[model samples]
Target: MIPNSGIAITIDIGDEHFIHAPKKKEVADRLLFNALNQTYGYNTVDYAAPIFNSQEKKNGGIVLKFKNAETGLYSYEKLNGFEIAGEDKVFYPAKAKIVGRKDVFVISDDVPNPVAVRYAWRNWVVGTLYNAMLLPTSSFRTDNWDDAIKAKK
Candidate 1:
């Protein structure tokens, strides 16, 4: 996500030098800008590095290490759409928990040797993961697979 992408606005008008409530249009404009920024993947802070390597654990899970996560990891209070995939299976809903450290997440699924993971990877997705500053994590995937939309067409 780019800096200054998160939308918040302030407007000054009229000659009154006193504090006043925000106008409806001002509120609406702020909402619209924020919604658009999120929709365009410009309002969130995502991983600083790609998932270059994955380590399989004895418990049938994989460990993923992320950079730029020193701020701590958190999930949105109500949203969940994390997934994992193996060579033989497609991406399926899975569970991920921050383990050992703030930047290390362990993803567990039924598949053996999980090869890839993804989060909020959809057109209408709203971010489910956030950093300590409450910035959302942009949609991301670890696989280099062909674009699903283009493949379908």
Candidate 2:
């Protein structure tokens, strides 16, 4: 697991096509800029993407808060890629939105008593959540409880 310290560097390699090959230099430049500004402290920079900070239960839904989101949050397109679950431990696709600055509210009709939430949990997820700096949020799960498969063993 990568620690939340300011020493980490993240880079997005993008797609595998001729059209994207030309963009590699741009991506590398951006990554270098982030590293210089964030890790080396050359200047004040928004280095890391916003990360999950906390959550709260509210009227049958879950409100998620984030750190490293001082500039606020957004999505490249419509918000998606969130899931919620109840005590049954069955996760279902959820509706999510940015509320206030760094808070995301998630809810699912299938999970009325949600106890946990996950974002971009799929193997090949196309996540959209990002900070105002346009850095994407990483996949995250709110619960550490053992899976049902483990419990059944």
Candidate 3:
């Protein structure tokens, strides 16, 4: 059962998010569940907790933005793990960091004038968000483009 707190297992860790992957019993086990069985009664909540997500594309220049990852937690340092693709249709982790409360900035460092931005859009994406109460939101992405670039071997 997915918890409402928005915490999940993935590779990316956002600004105000916490994780305990090493504690998971199985690959499918969620990180939050680790806190449940190992910590206090975390699973007691049967309903969806509040969720916050980041927003993107209010403007241009491949600006990365988040509506909410989970919640309370904010950014510390520049979070790596952003990828941008130009006309080449290649996706590679670009340089990324929290620019402000309403935006994140990303540069391809390889491609200039990038048009679209992508966060941890992967099903296993690791991201962050915060609620109004300052709690972590959850990992999410902005672009759902059907033509997303797949990594080449």
Ranking of candidates on lDDT, top first = 2, 1, 3
Clashing pairs counted in every model? 0, 0, 27
User: Model 3 segments beyond 4 Å from truth?
Assistant: 1-60, 68-73, 123-137, 151-153
Q: Which stretches of candidate 1 lie over 4 Å from their true place?
A: 1-58, 104-109, 147-153
Q: All models: lDDT?
A: 0.53, 0.75, 0.49
Best of the two (1, 2) by lDDT: 2
User: What is candidate 1's lDDT per residue for 49-144, written digit by digit as tens?
Assistant: 222234445367666655545666666464466677777547666777766535435355456677777776654444455555444455567777
Error of 1 at 5 (Å): 9.2
Cα TM-score per model? 0.54, 0.79, 0.48
Best by TM-score: 2
Q: How does residue 84 of candidate 1 score in lDDT?
A: 74
- RMSD values for the candidates in order, in angstroms, are 11.9, 5.1, 7.8
Q: Write one digit per residue (lDDT tens) for candidate 3, span 1-153.
A: 665343443343322334455524432344445456445566543222223244444333466444333332354345655677766666767776545454567776566656555655565544443333333334444546677775563
lDDT for model 2: 0.75
lDDT digits (tens) for residues 1-153 of candidate 2: 553234322223344343343455656665766777756877776677788999999978999999879889988677888888889888888899898968899998887799899887765566688889877788888998677211121
Stretches of model 2 off by over 4 angstroms after superposition: 1-23, 148-153
